[model samples]
Structure formats: C-alpha cells, structure tokens
Target chain A: MKKFLAITLVLALVVLGVAAKVKPIKLGAVLPLGDITGRQAANAMKLAVKEINAAGGVLGRPLELIIVDDEMNPSKGAAAIDKLATIDKVDFFIGGMSSGVHLAQIPILKKYQKITVWIGAASHLCEKALAGADWYFHLHPWDYQQGAGYAIGWKQILEKYPQVKFDRVFLAYEEGAFGTASYKAYLAMLEQAKQGEGPYVGLVKEFKGESFKSAAFGGGDYRAVLRLAKEWNPDAFIWAGYDADALPMMAQAKEIGFAPPIFIGAPPGWPADFGKSPLSEGVVLYGMWAPSLNKVSPVAEHFYNAYVKEFGEEPATYFAPLGYTNVYFLVEGIKKAGTLEKEALIKALEQVEYESPLGETLKIAPSAVIKHQGFTTQKILQWQNGKQEVIWPFEVQTAEFIYPFPKWEGR
Target chain B: MKKLGMLIILAVVALGFLFPLYAGPYPLHVMTTVLTYMALGLSWDMMLRTGQLSFGTAGFFGLGSYAALLTTLYLGLNPLASIFVGGVFAAIVAFALGYAILRLREIYFAITTLALAGVFTVVARNLHDFTGGPEGKILPSAIFNGDPTKVYWLTFSVALGSILVSELFQRTRIRFAITAIRNDEITAKSSGIDIFKYLLFVFVITSAIQGVVGGAYAQQYGFVSPESAFSTNFLLLPIAMCLAGGIYSTLGPVIGSVILGVLSEYLKLRFPYGHLIIYGVIIVAIVLFMPHGILGMLKKIAQKTRTEVGGNENEK
Candidate 1:
C-alpha cells in the first residue's frame, strides 16, 4: 500500500510541475485608450491573442496581453511602462500611438530592455530618441519616410495618368507639432527637388506652405490659409491637420470655391462619417491601409469580418490591422526561435516576413537610425462613392485615380 | 500630543526617504510623480496666501523647463546646475512681471497670468532654431540614466524643500503680513505692511519653486516639447490637488497629493477603460461633500471629539 501511494503522489507532482512550466507569454501594451486609434488597436490585439490561444498558442503555451492606458500624458505614459515591466512582469512590450507619449516611454523601455514591437509613433524625433535599440522593432514609417512615400506615390500617379498634373503643390498645415513637422518634411523635400537628388526631383516644381490653427485646438478658421492657397492656385492642395478640421475645412473650401486639381486631407484619422459626406468625393488622402484592401487580401477580409462580428463596429483605423500584426508577428518570431530566450528571439524576429493585412509583406530593414524598421511606405487613396479607393501602389489598386477634384457647384 | 505628532512627521519623512529600498520601480515612479504634483500644489497654495489668484504655475514651469534644457544643450551645464538656472530664470521673469501685473488686483491679474503660458508656448514654437520648433528637444539619456531610485530621491528632495518653504511661510512674520493683506489689502497697506513687497516676494519664491520642479521633470524625462512642457495639466492638476487637500496649510496639499495621486493610479489599474470617469466622479463628490477637503474634515472631527470630552469632564 505504501509503495502504490508513493508512485501516485510523484505522478501528481510531475503533472503539476508541467502545468506550471506552461505559463502564458505576457505582452504588455501601453496606449492612449481614450483615442480611437489606440482603442481599436487594443481591441485588435485582444482579438489576435484570442485567436492565437484558440489555435493552441505559440509553442503550445497561451498568450496573455496586459494593456495599460497612458492617458496621453507623458508622466502617466512613463509610469505605465514601469507598471508593465516591474509589476506585471510581462515577457514583451507592444503598442504605441502618440509620439509625445512614446518619447516619455523610451527611457523606461530602455531600462527593461524587453523585446518590443511598436505599431505607432511616426515622429522622426522618436527614431532619434530610440538610438538604435536592437530589441525595439518599429512598424510605422517615420515622418520623413511618409513624406518621401508621398513624393514617390505622386511620381507613380503622374506616370500612370498622363492627364494628371501636380507641378505646383501648396500645403496648409496646422500650427502644432504634427503639422509643423509635416511642413518641415515638405520643405526638405522641396530642397531635395531643387538639388534633383531625392524622390521629389522632377515631381514638385513649386511648393508653398502656410500654417493655420486647427479647429481641434480651438481655432477653426481655415479661410486665411485656404484663401492664400487659392491665390497660389497650385495644382495640388493639401492640409495637414486633425480630423475635426476635415468636414469644416471641406465646407469652407467649397464656400470660398477653392477646388484644386488634387484636394487632399492628410489627417491621421478621418471622421467616421467623412465618407458619407458629398464633399469627400475625389478627395485624395494618404494612409497605410483602407477597408477597400479587404477585397484584394484574404487576410484583410478575414480580419475585417472577424473584427466586425466580434466588436460590432467596423475597424476604422489602420491601427487595427497593425495592432493585429503586432501580435502575430511576434508569435511568428517566437515560433521560429522555439524558445523565449532574448538573443535567440531577437535573431528570429530579424528574419520574420509577416504577410500583413496592410497589403504588404512586412520585412525588417535598416532605417536611417534603427536596424529593424517595417512598412516604410504608405498608400495613396481617394474618397470615391463613399469609400476610400486605393489609387497608387498598383499591385493593391482598388480603383483608378480620380483626378480634378469636382467643382462645388454641383451635388 | 505635540511630541507624538512630531514623531509621526519624522517617521513619515524617514519612510519616504527609505521608500526606494523597499519598493519596486513602479511604485517609486508613481511616488515621484506624486511628489512633483505635491510640490506644485504647495507652491500654488503659497501664492494664493497673498490674496492674489495667480495662474502662472504652468507658465513658470514651462519657462523653467526650457531654461534648464537650453542651458544644458547650449552651455553644456551640469544637469543639476541647469535646474538652478531654471529656478533663477523663472524668478527673474516673475520679479519683472510681478511689478506690472501685481498692480492689477483680483480677476484681471489672474487673467493676465493665465495668458502667460499661451504667450510662452507661441514664442517657443516660433523660435524653431533654439527650441527645436514644435517637435521639441531630447536628451541623449534620462537623468541618472533612468535609475528609478535616484529619480525618486531627487523628486522627494524637491518636494521636501517645498514643504520646508511652506512651513517657513507658516511659522514666520511673512505669514502675518500675507494674512493681513489677504484680509484687507487697503488696511494692510495703511498698517505699514508694504503689501506690494510681500506679494512680489511670495510670487517670486513660488515661481522659483515651480521652475525648479519643472527643470527636474525635464531632466527626468530627458525631453521637453512646447506642448508637453507647457501643458495645462501642470496648472490644472496641482490646483485640483490643493483644493482636494484643503487650501492654505502645508499639510493640506501634501495629503491631497498622496490621496488623489495614488487613487488615480489605483483606479486606472482596477478599471482601465472606465477609470477616468470614475476618478472624475470621485473628485467631484469629494469637493462637493467635503468642501474643506479630507484634511479639513479630519481636523473638524478631532476638534469635535476634544470638545465632547471636555464637556463631559466639566460635568463630572
């Protein structure tokens, strides 16, 4: 009887030990959950974790995601990093949206030196602050990269549609960090164009920029800048501001009858009902991914359907797909590494070619400052029939280019 | 009773000094943030004791941030010395502005000081070459190389210094003059109190404290943007904490900072999505019901208890 009992007790202890060894891999995400971009990104991350767990997780261990809200305050954002690292003891770190918040978090992230895959913070200053930390993988294009991508997209468009003209470009930017940075990027591009050395060479001949206070920052008046742009009479007119300026800027543009050949709104995200507005027709914009990509990419389609069914709302921001990719990409790295060891995992992550829903195979490459940069380009799209139609990157073209922004006289 | 109270105060201070030894990085980080706000709250209340409502906390804080960062970047000054420069610059600016704005009383002065932050932000943004434009500037590394314990001690020392200044104001002749001015400025002037001198002195001192705190914050985070450094949160949150702790006394702002700061973090952890709403409701409820604040309520209870016991003793 004693011999039988001893064998049974040892078996029970072994089973318990194995169960303990199969602990879930924790991913800490710090984001501004109050914002739509952060909100949707978090939701998509949760969905990805759920699906991965349902599929028996990575290496037969479940994945756990712990999210903390940064409140968009720098101090709060830094504290969230500390909580995620020390308190939660998360294995990896992910999620980011604002450049300012990420700037504060960079120090703390460096302290922990955890493997991180961030999906936001497009500011080039963040790139400089990061200072080539190998453990960090940034998936968003830097501000300069985005600017070059726009020049490239325009070049492609001019080639594809000989009828379209964009020699002179006028930029109306908001007087904030984001808008100011965009203006600076354009100025640099113009300098490059003059030297005939960069992507903007032979693309932009005359570029003029004026700054305006965005409505989001309590200054809604865009008439001054718009009137200036109208006076310049550029072939392409673009405004770098917030979503709050989208409809009002359009309405005010129509009021002043200032319609250029290409009317572009380059806000980070648009109003949910923007596409429903009649003024949105033929308005060019730039983004990483759009809902129309669902038709071309089965992965995007599956993500869209599953997300809508799960959350009961459409994923309005590209952050949703990027956030989903943030998880799956890391899981793939883990699978390739076969263990969660830091050196091995970093090496494995360096080689991951994630077929992302962003309509691109995400491969890491050396950027200006960092070693692992993903998605160096954004897409050029236009609002047509209440839908954002991909017009550039011909392989993922959802619709043809809609040139000569329609006159405001008609419906 | 006095000795026991003294013992308690000493014990608390000692514990705070030793906190980093026992606690982890997260709590230390949270406490450091709380200390920053606590110092700001104390400084704000100090200025209020002069019967003047000054909304210049954020302005001076931002000015200090920029001053420290610029000195460090351009002059290659030591980080610690740059913080002193930040305070001195804020005091100089405040002393000059105080001469003009201090003449205006009540809401006019408040409104003018409130515009200081906006004016400073515009200047910082437009001076693209020096201030890095709107994108701001960053340090190569954080202060103390991102050491949580060292960072916490630095912030704790700042808060303690503010507390000492506040205590000095409470315990000295400056308190009587400020009290007289707050009670009736005309009467104070007639009594040979030199109201302008007292008000200017308090303003400069408080502004200096704010600048010092801001400089430390900039160094700790290793960056400063016009938007982040000059954020209205620096003004609004400290004011809220002072109100919640009770106004006028040094202990009020300290107690308020501890309670509201920790409660905010706790609520965030407990309910991430709905925490802000809940935190707002709690603050509103506290301000509405406890008008004088948690400290005031506790003092009232202590006073009533003593009165009840004294009445019973007299009857016996």
Candidate 2:
C-alpha cells in the first residue's frame, strides 16, 4: 500500500513536470468587460482561441487568453496593461475597445516592448505614437473617417434622394471628447463645402440649402432636451453620443413621439437588436464593420457562420467580428514572424495584410496622419423593416438609405 | 505593545523598500496600486476621526491629478515638484471649502461632500483647454522613464508618509479634540474643542495627503481622465479598507489595505466574471463577522488565547 501511494505521488509529479514544460502562449485582452459590447468581445475572443487550440495551438502549445477589465477608464486600463506586460508576461496584447484605454496603454507598451494592437477608433490614439516607434498597430475607423463617411452619405442623399429634402436639420451630440471631436470634424467638412475648399463639397451642396442647428448636451438628463428639440421639428435629428447619452435619448424620443424625416447619427444602443425595438425603426447609426454589408469576403462569412453557431444567435454587438479579427491578425503576424519574439512579431505586424471582416486585405500604415490604421470601407447601417441593413459607401451598400423616417406613432 | 507595533511597521517599511528586488514588474505595478490605496485609507481615517463622514476622496483625488497635470503642462516643473503643488492646491481648496461646509454635522456633511464630488466631475469636464476635459491628460513619457520598481518605491514612501501622519495625529492634542468631537460633538464643543477648527485642520491634512496620492497615481499610471481620476474606487476602496481593517487605528487601515489589495488581485485573476459581486459578498462577510474590523478580531483572538493559556497553567 505504501509503495502504491509512493508511485501515485511520483506519477502526479511527472504529470505536473510535463504540464509545466508545455507552457502555453498567452494572449491578453483589455476591455470594459462589464458592458455588453465588451462582454461580446471577450466571448468572441474565447471562441477564436478555442478554435485555434483545436487546430493545434501556436508553437505546439495551447493558447491562453487572459482578459482584464479596464472598465473603460484610462488609469485602470493602464493598470491592466501593466499586469499583462509584467505579471502574466503575455506574449501579445490586444485591446483598445476605447480610445482612452488604448492611449493609457501606450507608455507601458513602450516599457515592455510587447507587440500591442489597438482596435479602438479614437483618431488621436495612435497619432500620438512617437514618430519612429513601430511596435504598435491599430485597427478600426478613426472618428474622422466615421464623421466623413456620414457626411458623404448625407451628400449622397442630398444628390440622389432629392425627395428626402434635408434642408434644415437638428444636430444633438454629447459634449464629451469623442462627440465634440466627431461633431467638429463634421462641421469643418461642411464649412469646407460651404467655401468649396474641398472638391466634393460644391458638387454636393448645389443650393447652399444645407442649413442646420446644433446643440451640445451633457451625458445625463436627455429627456427634457429631446422634448425641446422635438418641439422644433427639424428635417432630421442627428444625435452623436455614446451608449449612455444615446440610449436614454432614444428611449425618450419614443416617449415624446418625435420622429423626423431622417434619424441618423452615431450608435447609442447598438447592433444589439436595436431593429427589434419599436423606437429604433428607421434610425441610422454610423459604425465600423457590419455583417449586413454587401461586399462580404469569404473570411467574413466564415467568421459570421462560426459566430452564429457558437453564440447561438447573430452577434448583438459588432464587437464579435472585431474580437475575432484581432486574434487572427495576431496569429497571422506571429506566423509571418516565424517566432514568438516581440520585435519579430512587431515587424511582421507592420507588414501584415489580413482578410478582416471590415475589408479585404486590411492593412495598417505606421505613423501617418491616420496613424497605424487604414481601411476606407466603414459601413453606415440603418434599421429597415425590423432588420439592420448597410446603406452607405456605394460599393458595399446592401440597401437604400430610408429617409423620411416613419413617425413613432405610425411605427 | 506600542514598541512591537512600531517595530513591525518599521520592518514592513524596510521590506517594502526591498519589494522590487524579488517581485516582477507586474507585482510591483500592483503593489504601487496597493500602496496608493493604503495611503487613501489612512487619509480617509483621519477625517473619520474628526467626526466627519466625508465622501470627497475622489473629488480631492481628481483635483490633485488635474492640478499636477496642469502645473506640469503649463509651468514645466518636475513631476515631484508638481506633486507638492497638487498637495498645496488640495490643502488650500480644503481649507477654504471647509470653512463654509465643515459646520454641517453628520449626514449633512456627508451629503455635502458627496455633492462636492459631483461638482468636481462637472468642473473637470468643463475645463477642456487646461484639464484636457473628459479625456484627461497623460504625463509626458519623459516623466516616468518606464520604471515600475522606482514608481513602487515612490508610492511606498508616500503611503508610509500617510501612516506616519496618522500616527502623529493620534499622538497630538488634535487627537483628543477630534476624539471628543467624534464621541459627542455638543459636549466636546461645550468643553471648548473648537469643533470647526479641529474639523478644518483634519480636513486640510487629509485632502493634502489625498492630493499627493492622486499625483503619485497620475505619475505612476502615466494617464488620468476625469472619469478614471475621479473613479469612485478612490472613494469606495479606501473607505472599505479602513472599515474592514478597523477604523480609528493606524494598523487597521494598513492591515486592511494589504488583505483587500491581495484579495482583490486574486479575485481579478481567479474570477473575472461577477468578481465585483464576489468582492461585495466578502465585504459583507467582513462587516458581519468582524464588526469592529480585522484588528478588533485579532485583539479578541489574542485575549482568548491568553485566557486559554492562563487557564491551562492554573490547571497544571
């Protein structure tokens, strides 16, 4: 019996030794995690990691994905980055669900020299990178692109869908850094058009009839302001804000029965079945990488199919594709580098061209004005007949922009 | 007993100074956070002793962070100099504000401090050009030089300084005045404790410490947004640490900080999902079992052990 116990202990030690010998490569993700979007990102990453392991993990070892919740705050995000860099000693870091979180991780990334990928669209995040450093890469449309995309779509409506007739519009945007930057960019684009400073503006605004009024509101107490805006009854009510400000305003718009011809702007509630809500009918949102887009790549289709199969439903948030793409990008970079070394991975990341859900052959250009991210094919999606459809960027548009939105009562 | 306590504290400080020797950069980073929170706990205890339940840790913390960032951005001072500037800024603000707001007793004072926190958030958001508004500011990369170990030592010193301040406060006549007020304000006022003056003094000291802690936080993290700097974690964690360890004592906050800090890191690693819920449950258990705190429970255990030993001796 004593010999039996001794052999069992030795066997257990041997198993432990073998397990320790097979060190898994860790992929660390920093996200808000509490929010639905953040949770979806985590879930999607988990699915990708599972598939990668099943297919025989990287470097003959299983992959371990560690998620740290930044809670959308920069300081916490920085702390999370520190843990990933130092404690967990993760081989690669993928994050930047928010621009602030991404920005916070920059200094630490410099310290660790770990290859970092940012998926947030905060325009200035990567732009602030030191001129020569090439260790970091970014994906996702910058706020400038998002703003410009909406403007171009609006221009398309102005020229093509003359029946919509958007003369006098009302713009309501949250007064945070994001909303302010995007709104200012939009205004500058319009002002450039007003002066014919840019080539596309004069041809688009034929009558200078593009008159609009705008108001900046705080994050809280949107109902009263929305009611006041409702009283004005403009041609279109364009609201640009985050989920917090946008969600409340959307619910209150339903309460006040303030439906305009075009309800267009940034995402508030989300890709999360906003179409199913009676209040969200005909509302358009500016976003990056929608599944509803027409120019779908085979890689994107495979991702969507896998996502639906694993999640048992279509992704409620657009983050699933983003999360999946981030993993694949890192995996592809590693494969190209032919080693797990940070410098090699970073060099490969710079030259990486992968089939992302957003674009075919999605590539990153290091240290330009756009700074590490370039993909012009962002999608502006609208809810039409209880389904979200891509409506902008003429080549990949799945459906026409539904202007002259049906009234809340009628819907 | 007092000598033993001091010896333990000194030994801990000495070991803390040597923490980076063995711990990796990640552990050092987490230790820096633990020290920052421990300092916050000590500072919070200072105010609680003055018979005020101030909920303005986040306010002063955010204020200090902005003050340091603006001073460095505009004045081009060293980060260390900026930390002092932040502390001075917080002290001046607290001294002036306490004159008006310190008169309110108990719940009113608590509510006022809570409102002041909201005021800080709005002010930070509005000061776009200076504070970088909601996005906040990241210290220039030159500021930190990317040394987590050095930052950990700096935070350890700041945290140790806060404990020393708490110890010094307890030793002074100010402690007697504050203790009297905490026990019974009207009686203490009758005994000429000068309630407002004592409260204001404690408020200034605590605010200054909190400001320095915030500056240290911004320096270490290298970034601070209005939301991150003014995070309720600054308010909640320190308060929880103080209460869980044992309020109105120097070692309580220290013990509490270490326990909670380690537990929090462990939970963050082990249970990322609903960890907040798990954390809440642990706090509830601590409050229930160790009503006075961990120190109180320790004291009880010590006394019980002594009794059991004496009883055994007598039986023999």
Interface RMSD of each: 0.7, 2.6
Candidate 2: pairs in clash: none
lDDT of the candidates, in the order given:
0.94, 0.75
* Model 1 whole-model lDDT (C-alpha atoms): 0.94
lDDT, candidate 1, B1-316, per-residue tens: 9999999999999999999999999999999999999999999999999889989999999999999888998888898899889999999999999999999999999999999999999999999999999999998888889899999999999999999999999999999999999999889989999988999999999999999999999989889999998999899989889889999999999999999999999999999898999988988998999899989999999999999999999999
Counted clashes in each candidate structure:
0, 0
Q: Write the per-residue lDDT of candidate 1 for residues A143-242, one digit (tens) a residue.
A: 9999999889888888899999989999999999999999999998789778878888898888999999999999999999999999999999999999
- Name the Cα RMSD for model 2: 5.1
- The numbered model that scores best in DockQ is 1
lDDT of 2 by residue, A6-125 (tens): 999999999999978998889889987777778878888888899999998876778899999876765567778878877788888886677656665677778876777766646553
Summing lDDT over every window of 10 consecutive residues in candidate 2 chain A, give the lowest-scoring window: A206-215
Q: In candidate 2, residue A112 scores what lDDT?
A: 75
Best by TM-score: 1
State the weakest 10-residue window (summed lDDT) of model 1 chain B: B68-77
Residue B311 CA displacement from its true place in model 2, Å: 4.2
For candidate 1 chain A, the 10 contiguous residues with the lowest summed lDDT are A189-198
lDDT of 2: 0.75
After aligning candidate 1 to the native by TM-score, how far in Å is the CA of A274 from where it should be?
Answer: 0.9
